[model samples]
Target: MRPEGIRLLPWLIGAVDLVMIALATVLAIRLRITLPIFSAAGDVLENTALASVFFLGTWLVLLVYSGAYEPHVFGAGTEEFKLVVNASFFTAALVATMAYLMQYPLSRGFFVLYFPLGVIALLVGRLLSRRVIQRLRSAGHFNEKVLLVGTPGYIGEIHTVLARESWLGYDVMGCLVPRDYAGLEVTSAGVPVLGLSEDVRAVVDEVSPDVVFFTAGAVSSSTQLRRLAWDLEDHAHVQIIVAPNVTDVSSERVRIRPVAGLPLMHLGRSRSQLATNDAKRAFDVIGSLTVLALTWPLLVVMMLWIKVHDGGPVLFRQTRVGRQGVEFTCLKLRSMAIDAEDRLTELEARDHVLFKSADDPRVTRPGRFIRRFSLDELPQLWNVVRGEMSLVGPRPPLPTEVEQYEDDMLRRLNVMPGMTGLWQVSGRSDLSWEDTVRLDLYYVDNWSMVQDLLILARTVTAVLGSRGAY
Candidate 1:
């Protein structure tokens, strides 16, 4: 059963979106009037207001049809925002086509301003609304009670994920296992086993849960699972979720096509192919140039500071592995003493894979400060501009580190190395080698432009908190 509050959430969001759309229209009109380039003849206020109502109604209908108001997408994921943007663009295009067909003199300026502004306003409103909803759910409001129907291992895995991601709004009530298990509770994860899977309907009636999640490899057969779903449909208001045993692959890469009453799931090509795509290369160049333009003054100051501190090279360059096992000169501000490399053997063990010491005597006082805040990374923007690295990717491995990598680990070299990446934002030096490899490989497998933007946003917080930085 969906939470009663959740049922009302879509209606509430629709109302809020309507208001935001109207506000965006008004702002667009005002902007047009103030800027002579967009000025037009006619009663601007009256015409614009009439246009706003028509566009607002049409946009709302599109949003509904596009699944922008779906409960599952409400407080999490980028799907809801993506739907809103798609709906807004489609609505704008439709409006333009209608105006042309009907021969109505609609202000070109109004729409030119409205399309981007409307989508932006709606996105902002939705973001704020999601924050409020997440806060409420975190405090034990609007959460669906879930009962797990799976093997012990599957139940444990699902429970761990749900527990870690509370914003997903699932509160695990308990689990139901095979009858052969004599225990009344799951000792491994502490969730009570409500009853055996054979008595699922009886257990459902007893527990009255809102959701029943069936993990892969749990049920005996699809027919049995289908029968259970059909039987429960008549008895309870329960939503069934089935995990398909797929991992590290996103929904966007999976295409479900039904042919001859059979559903076929087709997986797309690896995202590593995108590393060489023209669009990603363009983004790297543009993003790097923009950042360099904005931060040149700070770059100059850092360069001068490093020079004054040691009277040495302002920039430190090292040979690092790039995409496809290529080598490149990775640049950074010189944050250590001139003889820091010579002292490495005396200060620490040589057996480590990714080597760093917490209180290495080679690091000067200024070096410590710069490394903490990642000021040393600014020089890498030049590498990004030169196309040797991206603004975001797995960290470039040193030659020795790459030499030690196993076959699977070399997959990280499929994409260009980065100035900042999952490893950088997740935990610089504090993360274990295993975790670092996991994150880097995950990035390689599931790279998306949106993920890159999100990582870049999180990087600021990570640098400021300095939780795992050394």
Candidate 2:
């Protein structure tokens, strides 16, 4: 069941937008009036008050028209932020056009400041609001009652994802399995089977679900699915979503097209195929240089501390498989004793692929502290700058680990390895070998510049929290 306040989400978002827009307007006006940086500040406060009111209303109207306040776009994904950006640009263009045509005396400096400030303010507010919504969803509020319609196997897959990502706010009320499994109490994923696909209408009416998801094998044909949608047209409040068979693909790589009156999904080339390697390389160089410039002192201090802790080498270099199955020396701070390699064979591996231990006997006193916060990996910045690694990609695999890779698993070697990637931010040493491969492969296939930046941002939080770190 959803909270009563969940219904007011759109209004709440609009209210937040209004406050941000007003804040931006006030700040822009103040900056323009007080700061002498801009030479052309005409009618700073005379007509500005009246114009600010008009601009705020226009901005809100453009945002609403751009579908920025739509319910589906809220609390998830980048669509809301993208829409806000587009609306801000649209608002700026519209106001500028109006001012030009009417010959209105608007301050040029304020006009320049307002739109950018508004975008930043709006995005920040939306981000904070999303955090609140995620917390609420985790607490079992703002949940959308979901009824699944598919075979037992398909239903299980969908249910697993919903259960894993509770922040999506989909509460699986029950599922409708195939007719053969109608007698069963529940599917393997533990979704209670309500009825067969034929009983969808009655079952939806009985459950009064907010959403009815048609997973793969839910119906025999497109005609049957279309008919199901038509039959449920009477229930206007219910949203019918069809989950295509595709999985592990980002939305950026998929698009829907009408091919001969049939809705067809077209898959675009992966990031590697898009020839973004040069851009990625430039970004890595620039990013690594900046990070090194800022953190060199800290790196030096840690190096000395590690060296002083045990009169051993400050750096540890290991041979790891990189892009195209090449070998590279991956650099890291020596977090383990000099004789740690000798003791490896004596200890049983906790993680099958990565061979990580939560409490290893080989870790030095200072090693534990640095390892937990990922300071040990800071030396890899030089490797990144040297082009042996990327700022963001899959985790580098040792030679022994790469030797065990299956043909499909070897696809991870298509991109340069990274100091930290999806595996690091997700669960680090806590993730299963299978999950680690899954996340690494996902990152390899679906990488973007924005995705890299997001991973870097999340990496900070993950390192600070020290979750799943040994």
Candidate 3:
């Protein structure tokens, strides 16, 4: 897409939102008043129609004010949906307050219904828009040209991430390395060198990029950054973004505190520090019981299948490390031969930390089918109900695996082991040992109720896809 056409993307989103809000308004009137669209004329109906126009105007204004239409939030992250929700609820409250103060007899039912309808419609519309935009980005449309400035290693790190997540729509046009490293032609990640980092403004002007990303080591000091910012004021179309060295931290944990013109990022405590509380415990217990109640019959069938496969034990109980380094009996339906543990020392290990193989000879016929869709994990729900596990957390490691953990890896022990976690949803046994540890640490540092819910939701898709399950 042309730059000018790209500029209209936000307006296009606004147009889609306008239609969604209008549909909500009509639906709210229909449901609340039980009348056709603006028909069956009466004072109350006439007043309601007029009030809806005001509501529509207020909703659009609030959406824009909430930054829902900003280009940065176009098709990625939770910011756009969060803004839509906040704006919808705020508009509802504001409208209700104005009506009460003005002594206008607005239909209470319509007022209550409209905002919720609008929120749902807007959210659905936004999700659909995201799908379309992501497809376009994959086809090389609606992408922002990004120019990077930093040391080669830092620039390469940023480039690697952008290249991996195409849906983020960042196209690395080129980069500027420190003057001492100007002899290099391209970054390790293959981003071509455009100029010296000290001459960032000239490079940016010459490249005409949509975004200029300054990673650590891009400037000698804050004064240099300030001076560069001042100089770049002429390039009104370019956006300057400074990236800290941190990665995998959630936005909820970071607060921007600007003191004396310096921005400081204050990170909140990790979930391991706070530990599990009554709310998470309650969610675990309730979620486990609910899932168990629905799947008990399936569980029984799996047990029977496993038992019949080899006339072996139906349940496989193994010692696994739990919260605070405690050991618990982690249970799963038997997916291997009775002597599988005895053969562990004989088989070659695929992963350095975790033991898994796609075609292990110990796996019985029933094991392959159950392991494919993770039906073997159903038995662990009982562990969750017993309080030895959670509905979502870091994957429980075996006692042997715990012995190999470094000090940083020990942080996973702070939270209760989970039936399914970031590891399970990500790739199960397919992830590299380092990637598994990184994801677990990220979850331990940034776990939240909402995040748990989202992970649970993704777990279904992951299980169905069975991309990495052994």
Candidate 3's residue-wise lDDT over 352-373, tens digit each?
8888888799998999999999
lDDT value, residue 392 of candidate 3: 90
Question: For candidate 1, lDDT tens digit of each residue in 1-470?
Answer: 56788788999999899989989988998887788776464677677777788988999999999999988889875788889989998998999999999987788887799889998899879877876887788888889999898888778888987886687789999988876675667638888888877677998888888888998655788787888787798755688888877766766678989988667778887788776678888998998889889988988888888788879898889999999998999988888899988877787563558988787778776778888888888888889888889989998999999999999899999999988888887678887787788789878887888778767866887798776776
Backbone clash count, each prediction separately: 1, 0, 0
Model 1 clash pairs are 1-210
Report the C-alpha lDDT of model 2 over 140-193, residue by residue, as the tens digit: 988899999999999999998898779889999999977777699888888898
| Residue 433, model 1: Cα distance from true site in angstroms | 3.9
Each model's lDDT comes to 0.84, 0.87, 0.86
For candidate 1, report its TM-score: 0.86
Q: Give the number of the best model, judged by lDDT.
A: 2
The C-alpha stretches of model 3 lying farther than 4 A from their native spots are 1-57, 74-76, 98-141, 342-347
User: Which residue pairs show collisions in model 2?
Assistant: none
lDDT of 3: 0.86
Better of 1 and 3 by TM-score: 1
Query: Model 2 misses residue 203 by how many Å?
Result: 0.9
Model 1 misplaced stretches (Cα beyond 4 Å): 4-23, 39-42, 124-142, 234-237, 309-312, 336-373, 423-432, 457-467
Global Cα lDDT for candidate 2: 0.87
